[model samples]
Target: MKTKRVMIASEEVEYDIIRSSRRTVALYIRPGGSLLIRAPWYVPAYVLLKFVESKAPWISRHRDKLKEIRPDQPSTMINAGDKIPFMGRELTVRAHENSRNGIYVIEDEIHVSVYGALTPEKITAFIDNWYLKEARNYFAERTQELVRLHGNILPVPSSVSIRKMKRRWGTCRSNGAILFNRELIKKDKELIDSVIIHELCHLVHHNHGKEFYALLESIIPDYRQRRRNLRNL
Candidate 1:
């Protein structure tokens, strides 16, 4: 991959072209803010540049998504006898031959009883699935609680739904169908609650205006902290 300079709106928007075996051209921005253009090994530089130029609008639109990019935190495997943090404290996972396939949060650690030795990737996959299941349950209960608490002040009667969104943590639809990012499962429970609460506030005010923020502040006092912690996760 090599970077080539290009001018956009009087600012230098760099274009990186990565040579690959397949015949394709795709552009992306790394989490660290580096721009990339992936293309086939045989594709010419001029052709790739033209494609990028045509997709400039798309590039800019995706830049907003890049703003949400946070540095990766160190992660370890959720293996046997390994302790991992949930909301704040650590839980130790203990694998037992007689135990069933499940995860339990014990004092100071989470216990995962696996049947056999698994790779870190496989363990993470299991943990992620477990969290997603838990998130669905938690969100359903909490959304109902919020509706009961603030429905009187909200502008519309909305329903909450869960889905795996790539670019957004949560979105409030005009019809009031709130959607949450499935990635939230990777974080702790408190962070997940914060995201839920944030979306619930949107039920009252759709936009991030002064009234919306004011209401959110009243409902979730430490929303900013929650936002920060979520980004860190």
Candidate 2:
């Protein structure tokens, strides 16, 4: 692993260049905005630099796009004995050895299944993948469900993107593509609808104005309460 600094647009970007047996170089920006470049160890420094330079514009745009959607609150850490909110209920965390499984949910509890040994890192990784997978499937389904229910309010979004957003709940773009916070899967369905509706309303009115609220209210009579509940969550 090596740490390299390069100028991307106006910002000085520092990234971790990790070499592995992998055949391709991949660039990614993790949460808290850490950049990583995974590549073959044999790649030359000049080639890597040029690759970074070529991706500088994309890197800046990608970070800026995320900035438009994250929330204002600090991130929450998931651990054993901690309860997670899901579909309007708190799902308790429980870990057990499954010998051949990963994780699953039953009733109001989430079960983490492992094979031989367990560590905090392994548990965390399992839960992260589980939550993201759950979020992707559930969010995609709900987006379609809502579109069917309220497409008259506005047509369903052309597509939906799910990601681990920091501060914001969701963002509806001008192109009819919607970005949803994966964490929203933790909230109750009603609150989730309010978020979808809010963004959908943005398609008609891009600002928080009287008409936007009026449109939202038409769809969600208790939008105010639902928004408050999300804050409390």
Count of clashes, each model: 5, 6
Model 2 misplaced regions, further than 4 Å: 1-81
Model 2: which ten-residue window has the lowest total lDDT? 66-75
**Cα lDDT tens digits for candidate 1, 127-210:** 665666666776677777766776775443366567878677888887878787766655677677777777777777778899
RMSD of candidate 1 to true structure, Å: 13.2
Q: Write the per-residue lDDT of candidate 2 for residues 73-111, one digit (tens) a residue.
A: 325556677787777788888877654445778888888
TM-score against native, each model: 0.54, 0.64
Candidate 2 TM-score, C-alpha based: 0.64
Local accuracy by lDDT, each model:
0.65, 0.76
Which candidate leads the pack in lDDT?
2
Off by over 4 Å in 1: 1-76, 98-100, 116-122, 154-159, 165-167, 183-191
Report RMSD for candidate 2.
9.2
